[model samples]
Structures are given as C-alpha cells and as structure tokens.
Target: MDQPAIPRPRGRPRRFNPEAAVATAQRLFHARGYDAVSVADITAALGINPPSFYAAFGSKAGLYKQVLERYAHTGVVPFRELLRSDRPVADALAELLEQAARLYAADPETTGCLVLEGTRCIDAEAREAARNFHLAKEEALRGFIAARHPEAAGRLTSFVSTTMAGLSAMARNGYGLERLLASAEVASCAIREVLSTSEEHPS
Candidate 1:
C-alpha cells in the first residue's frame, strides 16, 4: 500500500487570551456596576477595540452574562453548597461567612457580588433572570434547612436568604474579613434569637 503524506497544519490560531479578557471584564464590572461599564470601558480594560471585543464575546451584554456565569458557577455555587453541608445550620452559615472572608483575603480589590450590585441596573428581562437565580438559590438553601431542621426551616430560610443579599452589599462597601465576621456573628446571634422566639411562639 502506498503511504500518504500527512499535511502540515495551517497558520497559527488567532491570538487572544479570553481568560485575561474575562478577568479584566470581571474587574471592570466589579469596579463599576453593569450600567456604568460601557463597551469602551471593557475594550480599554482589555486593551482591545470594540470590534475585537464584539468578535470575541458577541456583545457587551454577552460578555457581562459570561462574567456573571463565571461568578455564579465559581463564587455563588460554593456559597449555596455550604448550606447543603451536613454541619449545623449556624455552622453552614458560618462557613459561608468564612468563604466570604477568604475571598476578601484573596482579592485586594474585591467588590462584593455582581448580582447584588447589578440588581438595580438590570432591566425587566435581566431582573427576571436575577429573580430566578435568587429564587433557585433560596430553594436550595431552603431544601437544606428543611432537611436538616424542619422546625426552623421557615425562619432560617428567610434569615439566610435576606442576609446573603446584605452580605454582598457589605462586601461592596469594602467591609473586610474582620468586619464581616463581626457582622456575621451579630447576625447569627439575632437569627438564633428569632429562631428561639419563633419556637416559643409557634406563630
């Protein structure tokens, strides 16, 4: 049999670092809320032009959504997973605060969460999407609470969900790990008080 010669590969693939671009976008997005970050800002941050950005990410909104997905899968997922841990609810809540602390300790310019920051910027469609995401997170936390502490599920669900939102705001406000832990301890104490109060009243 005659051996066919293998063809050499063609020219080099287009050179662009999507991860770098995304990280830049994430930083810019966090620094300024979604509405404040124009396409030009993204391009300027990535050191690229509008055409290149659109070519790479489809659109500004597309890139925004992608960065959001990155945060959701990486940041938010772990927060929700803490609620699912076999540890006690207070411990799980503390775990979430600990993770928040770790994030603060890691990122020098960390500015809390995007969804919390963008909640006001989101339009009708984006608001709906945010709502769904929040609801899903609540359901996950609630499921864990129901499974682990049925009697306190309702109160704990409300407490965790509401304070999660507040924690994101606190992060945006430049609250450090120590301040956040102090706030968490206070919130935990209040939560326990409410739980105990509710148990007594059964209302």
Candidate 2:
C-alpha cells in the first residue's frame, strides 16, 4: 500500500534567483523609470511569469522596495565614506559632488541617479520609498556639515542636495560627463563661497 505521489504544481517552476531578478529589474527601472516599467516588462525581461514574480516579491512595489535597497548599496555614492569628518568639510563635499556627476553621467543608456529619479515616480508607494532614501541622505549631509560649520549646515546641505538634483536631471537630459563636471565644478565653487562667507561673517 504505497501512497500516491503528490501532484506537481503546474506552470513554470516557482523559482527564480531573487538577487538576479533584482539586478535585472534595477537596470529596467533605471533605464525606463518606475511607472514606465511594468510587471510584465520585468517578467519578460527575467524570463519568468507573473506567479513567479508575485511569489518572489509579493507585488511590483515590493520588488521596487528591494530594488531601492539594492541601488542604495550599489548604485549610490558612498556618502559616509566620502564625507569624512577628518577632512575639510568643503573639500569633502566638493569631491562628493564631482563623484556624483561622473556617476550620474557614467551610463548614457541609464543616466541620472536611480533613487533621485525615482523620487519623481507617479506611484505613491514607489515615490515615498525613494523619498525615504533621499531624506536619509539629506540628514547625513546635514550632520556632516553641522559637525564643522553649524551655522552653515542648513544652507550648505540645501545647496548640495539641490545641486545634486540638478546634476541628476541634466545627466538624464543627455548631458555628457564633461558638461556635468563643469556643472559640478560650478556647484563646488558655490559651496566654497558659502563656506567662506560663513567663516568671514562668524554667524
């Protein structure tokens, strides 16, 4: 009296390399943005079906959340490292901006910062997700500046964030690395000027 074998599930195997899927999806999202890349697009790109995708990520937003985390670790600049407390704050910030420009324009096919660009996404959840990363970066920048230049922290942080956003937009609009570097240099100059002013005024 042997027991009957359990019936195998139908359709494509419910197995996919989640890490590989995230890597593939990051490229898609980076190239086309959040709203533009649909679940079907992701599935077709990954050679998997909706059920597999859902089982792996729960939903499009769920996958996007993972993608955002991946981008933060891999795609984004290492802010904590670059904003070293031992170095002059202005120089550190200048280097950070230059690095960002090069990275944003590094890939012509996938221009702009993924997390920054994702902030403008139409999906509320995705947009909020990106914003969380954006806000965290902002706080980090602020803290770095406040350590040395408490008075200039607020304005300098704002200026740096705004410049990075502009650089991201310009890169997305086909600006080459040379032009982006020029923009970054101009931003660096502005940051130095602000710091100089703050030092001179002593307020």
The model with the greatest TM-score is 2
CA shift at 154, candidate 2, in angstroms? 0.8
Query: Mind giving the per-residue lDDT tens digits that candidate 1 earns over 55-159?
Result: 899977778677777778665538656765556666776676656545643565656666666666756544555566667767777777667567778877887
Residue ranges of candidate 2 with Cα displaced over 4 Å: 1-14, 200-203
Instruction: Assess the local accuracy of residue 17 in candidate 2 as a C-alpha lDDT between 0 and 100.
Output: 85
The Cα error of candidate 2 at residue 128, in Å, is: 0.3
RMSD of each: 4.7, 3.3
> lDDT per residue, candidate 2, 91-187, as tens digits?
9999999999999999888899999999999999999999998999999999888887889999989999999999999999988999989999998
TM-score of each: 0.76, 0.91
Candidate closest to the true structure, highest lDDT: 2
Model 2's TM-score against the true structure: 0.91
RMSD versus native structure for model 2:
3.3
Query: What pairs collide in candidate 1?
Result: none
